[model samples]
Every structure is written in C-alpha cells, then in structure tokens.
Target: MADQIRPKWALVAHGGAGAISRGQLSPEQEVAYRDAMAVAADAGAAVLRAGGSAMDAVEAAIHLLEDDPLFNAGRGAAFTAEGRNELDASIMDGATLGAGAVAGVTTTRHPISAARAVIEGSTHVMLGGEGADAFARSQGLEQVDPSYFFTERRWLALEKGLARLGLPIPARPTGAPQDLSGKAALVHEEGKYGTVGVVALDAHGDVAAGTSTGGSSAKRWGRVGDSPIIGAGTYASNKGCAVSCTGAGEYFIRLGVAHEICALVRHKGLSLQAAADQVIQGELTALGGDGGVICVAPDGQMAWSFNTPGMYRARIADGEPLVVGVYKDET
Candidate 1:
C-alpha cells in the first residue's frame, strides 16, 4: 500500500567538497558556483516534478554538471600527471538494485550515459579503459577525441602538483609519479579536489544516485577513485535512501561512506540526517578525509553533510524554493 502511494519528490546535488574558504573565491566566482548548483538542482527536480523515475532524474542532473566546465567531472576533469584526462562515472537504480559504472575511460563524451547503457544493455556491473570506450561506441553514445577533455585550468593544477613535488616540468608528459602520497595531499589542499553527483526521490518513492569524476589531479597508473565505485561513492535502495559522495577515494572506500549511510538507516534505525552526519562528520573526519555527500530518502527527506570547510551543494523539495550554498556556514 505504501508503494502504491505517490510521494512528494525531492532532489539534491553537489559539485565537490574541500577547503572552500570565503576569501578563496571572488564575489563573482561565488555567484557562479551558486548559480551552477541551482541549475543542477532544477534540472533533476524538473524530472521528478514531471513524474520521471529517480534514476532518470539523477542522470539528468549529473549531465548538466558534466557539461559545465566549472566542475571537475567531465569537460573540466583534472589532468593526470602526464597531462591526460581519464573520466569515471557510475549510476544506480534503487528500486531494482541495478547499477553500472565505467572507469579509466577516455573519448566517451558522457561517461554517465555510458554507465546507464551498461546498466540497460549488459549483464556486467562495470567496464574500464579501452573496453568501456568500445562499449560506449556500440551503444551510440557521443564520442570525442581525448584532446577534447583538455582544459587550461586543470593543466595548471598539474603544473602546481609537479611544483609541489620539487620536480621540473618534463619535456614530455611522462605520466605521474608512481607514488603520489605528498603530491595528492597538496592537490587536495589547494582545492583541486572535486567530483559531481546527484540523488533523487521520485513520485513513486524510488530513490537513485549517480556520481562522476576525472580522478585526482596528477594521478597516475589508471588510478580510480570512489566516484565510480558503487557502494563507496554511490548507493541507492528503495527501502532506505540514495547517497552520492565526493571526497578522498581511499578513505571513502575504506569507510564505505555511501552505503554506510543507507545501512545505518535500514539497520540502525537512524534518520537520514543522523546517518549522513555520522559518516561525514564522525567517521570521515576521524579518518582525516575531507568531503561531502547528498542524500534523498524514500520518504522525500533530504540531507547533505561534509567535513570540509565547504561543499558546493543544493537541494529542492516539492513546492519549496531551491536552497543552494557553497560554504558550511550557509547551511
């Protein structure tokens, strides 16, 4: 009977999480970030308002972000140490527990759409590298040259990373270092850490989540982060909620941040807000990982939490004005 009843819809999204201090951004830049959040939120909420599935809503929202160069997921993805871009994405449908993902992919115009194709067309849960690109082509997804991913801003970040390591700019893109311990920390601290994600609750009460990223700046050896890992960065369940995370991939994977929130709700009887806070504020902070997540519950409740100084995020529920913020203080 509960499943038969239509619920009010809600949608939420995040650009990324990190030390986004007030003085770091100009007034115009702040407005740009907030405006981007509102656009992303409106895109997804529009689908929900039209009685679309949560899966569709989440995908629609992420598409808008991926197209925007302001975020670090698709067009503006960070460059590897070798100055190349390798994109990753994942999507999940909570109603059926079906999911799809792609990693180390290049040339696929929209990695999220490829992920959706994998869910709808294949028996596999994920594909990577050349194989994923081939599949995307077969599905008729838009394809682009790898050069299309290049952005001057991300290239500068790579240069900064090399500088932090006391390494000279190589004559050629020799790829990143084998071990990027200190280097990765420098990239994150400089606010180059980013990802894009969305979660939605549809009129039918189903929840879905999706995430996309370009991996870490100056990363090497086909490194994959939490963005494309289903439970680590994205999860959804009709019985609980949908979660999309953006943070240090290793910590999120080890802590199972995304699924942990859903598990807390299903097994521990915690509300969506409490569950998200426990993971983002408690476990993640204790582990020294700075990031955040957007969550939407089956009951149309929404929650977002981050341990960092700021997270680019927005939320909208039925009949409510969009609420967008980039700093912790605003929320």
Candidate 2:
C-alpha cells in the first residue's frame, strides 16, 4: 500500500556557495557551471520521475556532481595541508531517518555512494579515514589512486591558501599534474568554498538529502567539515523537509544548519522558506558565517537561501522547467 502511493516530487541541488559575483566568472565559465548543475539535477529528476525512491534520487544527483571537475567533490576536491585529497559525504532517508556518512576518504571514487553503503549495508552511521576506504572497498565500490583527484587548479589554490594563512606551502603530491603554469586566475574565492549537495522529494512522499565536499583548501591535520556529519550538513524528514548545506563548515557544524532547518519547520510550525531564511539570514549570519542551502519538501516547496554574494543552485519540480542561479539576484 505504502509503496503504491504516488505524491508530488521535486529536487534541488547546490554547487557550493561563497563570494561568487556577476563579474567573478567568465561568460564561458558561468555557462559551464550552470550546464553542469542542470545535468546533475536532471539526472536526479529523471530517477524521481521514474518512481525511484528519494534516497536513490539524491544519490543519483550527487553521484554526477562528484564526477564533475567544475564543482569540488571527488575528482576536483581541495587539497589538504599535506597536498593530498580527502573527501567527505553524507546522505539521509526521510522515510526511515536512516543516515550514513564518510569522512577523510582517500580512495573511494564516489564518496556519496560510500556514504549510502554505510546506511544500507553497515550498522554504523558514519566511517572515517582508512577504515572508511576499506569498508568501501569491501562493498566493491570504485577505488582510484590518490593522484586521480589532483588537478592543477586545486594545487595552485593550495599554495595560495597557505600563503594567505601565513603558513608554509607543502610540496606537491608525488604524481601531481605537471602543467601548473596557468589556471591560477581561474581559481578564486569560489573554489575555496566548493561543495555539492542534493535534496529530493520522491513520488512516495519521502524526502532525502545528501552533501559532498573536498573541504577547505590547505586544511590542516585531518579536519573534517560539516559535509559528512549527519544533522550538520545533511538532513531529511518525511514530517517536513530535506536540506543540504554548503558553507563555512565550522559554523554550519556548530549551528547544525541542516537539522536546524528541518527542526524549525517540523517543530516551530514555520514554513520551509521561513525556516531556511531564519537560519541562513539570522542565525548563521549572526554567527558570522556565510553560505547557502537547497531544500525540498514533500508538499512541493523548493527553496534556497544564501548570505553570500551568490550561490550556484538549481531546482526542478515534477513538470516544471529547471531553474538555475549563480548570482544573488536570480530569484
């Protein structure tokens, strides 16, 4: 009976958020970002329109984004202080409240899939470091050499980050790309806050959310951001809405932005837009954090809010056309 129920559906996605502005991206660069987002969102929307579960739709969307170099997730993830790539991702099912996550993953080809494996195949809600990669390997997920994630654009960004922070720049990765002469100007404030996320409402009236990131460039130690932490960067609930956030990971973590948004909607009788606005505009801003979120509810509400100059975002409802935005003005 429950499986036969069909309901309104929608999907929303974000390709990170930060001080992105109108003149910041070249016309070609802007088109590339928008096209990539549309393709990813379309992939997920196709799944939902085909009667896939919210969980599957969310995974389908993020999986495509993780593969794109334009957005930081898998292939173009940021470099750590050691110049190595460490990925993080998380996903949640609104129908069951079952969530999974992975942090500091080194070799998994798709961190989003690895996170889903945690929810469906393992007892744990989260896994980290070598163990997380090992578990992903055991599940037969694709594995890549560390160098596979390295891009010259990100390598230079690492140096700039170290310089800006007044820290020593580390040596390049062992098998790094050789052509680092150019592409530096192409890398700017946007890459520093790069992450990808998706929120979907499937035909079953279930909502699911997922988020993936490469963390901050030149992040020291084993710093894990809010991306892989349940209730922090990702949250979904059948009772209200699903949310995926990209921002200053530290503040988002402290504020529990994802879960907080859903809580406001489900508990405080706030509308989805109001709840999101209050969090991103009021609470997060008050705390001196700037970023954005994409949300979808089972009732067909799709909303996004960011305090920065712009956020790369897209959303699509059942029969509607896909809409995308890069700057703050594109409502």
Candidate 3:
C-alpha cells in the first residue's frame, strides 16, 4: 500500500574499493571495467523502469557485478588463507528494517538471495557462519560446487600480496599467526578499491540496499568483516536513506559507517548527502581508514564519496541507463 510514491528513481554501484590509479591500469583495462559496469547498471535500471521493486533492482544490479570476474564478489572472490573460497553478502529493506546475511557460505549459488531470504523468513535480523548456510539450504537456494568459486587471478593476486608482505611464497605456513604489519601495509597500499554495492529507488518509492564481497585477501578463518553485516557494510531505512559501503573493514566496524550515516540523518537533521560526506571525509579518515561508498536517499537523490585515489563506481538515472565506470579523478 505504501509502494505508490513516484520518486525519480536511481541506481549506483561499485566494483570494489582499492588503490587503482591511472598509472596502474592501462586504457584497455579502464574500458573493460566501464563496459562491465554499464552492463550491470542497465540491468538494474531495467528492473526499475519496469515498475519493479527497489529490492528487485538492487539485486539485479548486484547479481550482474557478482557474475563478472572483473570485480571481486561471487565468481571472482578472493581466497581464504586455507586456499578455499567463502563468500559473504547482505541486504536491507529500508521500509521495514528487515535484513538478512550469510557468512562463511561456500555452496550457495546466490549469496544475496540467501540474505534476502533471511530478511523475509523470520523475526531474526541477522544470521551467520554455518547457521546462515543451513538457512540457505532450507530455503532451497541454488547450490554450487565449491570449485565453481576458484579463480586463478584472485589466487595469484593474493600470493603476490603475501610476497610483498615478506612472507614465504607459496607456503603460507599452516597454523601460524600471520605477521600483519606488512600485510596491513599492503592492504592499505591497495585500499582505494571499493566493494560491489547497490542502492535503488523503485517506481513505488521504496529503497533497498545490498553489498557483497570476498572479504580481505587471504583473510583468516572466521574473520568476518563488514560486508555481511547490516549496519557496518550496508543499511537501508525509509526514514532517510539506503547505503552500501566498501573500505577498510576494521575502521568500518569501529565507526559503524552505514548505520552511522542513517543516524546522522534521522537524529542530527542532516541531509543524506551531508551525513555521508561527513562520515567518509571526517570520521573515517580521522580513524586512518580510507575507501568510498554508493548510496541513494529515499527521495531518489544519489551520491558517491571516497577518500582514496580512485573508486570503481558507476551510476544510472531514470533518463538513461548507461553504465559509467571510473577509477581515477572525475574530470
């Protein structure tokens, strides 16, 4: 009954937040990234154009990013220290405070769908680890062979990152606590890359938010970061806005970035843009964390903010469904 608002409707996405610079990527890579982003943006916009729910548009857009190996979500997820792939994802519906999440799930074909199931299934606001995986099975979510997640590119990238950490190559010692100083530096060095995020305003004016990731490269077991957490990595609330973020997980967890943005809007009387900008440029930076986010307010306004050299981002509006991806300065 509340789904009849005719907001302008918008969609935004990010591939991943990291330190990608013009100097690092060839023109060819830039073109390919934009091409893929356009494809994803169009898919999302199409759903919105057809009077689909904001949830549908958000999921459609994110699903495109998930399937693309160019980004680090589902198919192209990074590897765990054990050389296995575990994916995490979450979704939120702004109108209801309903949310769902999955962690350490290796077999679900659509991690995001599992998250949505959790959002609608019960009164529980979150689920994790084996519990989340089991919920997926009970819901009849598609399952994939574990090997379907393997990616040589991601593996080799993590291996190189480990090498730069001054750790032994190829061995990644068993049961040894990693020396994180060097690894942290490497992570910071590549900290500008953003995560795959989606925010949508459907024809009915409802707002939805979603985020998915492979987590940090070579992350430890049970070391779940913010990606699958509602208030940290993503949040949606009809009272103000819907947000999805990508950045240093440690700082995001510390700051509660997503929920904090919504709170500033609901409590301080700040606009969605003002709250988001403040958090990204003020609080997050002060905490020594860097990254960016893609968001949409309930009014259908949109924004992207980052403190790093570049963020892989794209946007589509009601008028045009073009996908535009950028890695460096925006003119």
> For each predicted model, how many residue pairs clash, with residues at least 3 apart or on different chains?
0, 0, 12
Q: What residue pairs are clashing in model 2?
A: none
Please give me the total number of clashing residue pairs in predicted model 1: 0
- By summed lDDT, the worst window of 10 consecutive residues in model 1 runs over 181-190
* Alpha carbon lDDT of each predicted model: 0.85, 0.89, 0.76
Best by the TM-score measure: 2
In candidate 3, position 198 carries an lDDT of 88
- In model 1, pairs of residues that clash are none
Cα RMSDs of all predictions? 5.3, 2.9, 5.9
lDDT of 3 by residue, 56-79 (tens): 888988888877766677866776
Off by over 4 Å in 3: 1-7, 164-194, 320-323
lDDT tens string, model 1, 81-129?
7677899999999999999999988889889999999999899989999
- The parts of candidate 2 lying over 4 Å away from their true place are 1-7, 179-191
Query: Which has the higher TM-score value, candidate number 1 or candidate number 3?
Result: 1
User: lDDT rank, highest first?
Assistant: 2, 1, 3
Query: What TM-score do all the candidates reach, one by one?
Result: 0.92, 0.95, 0.88
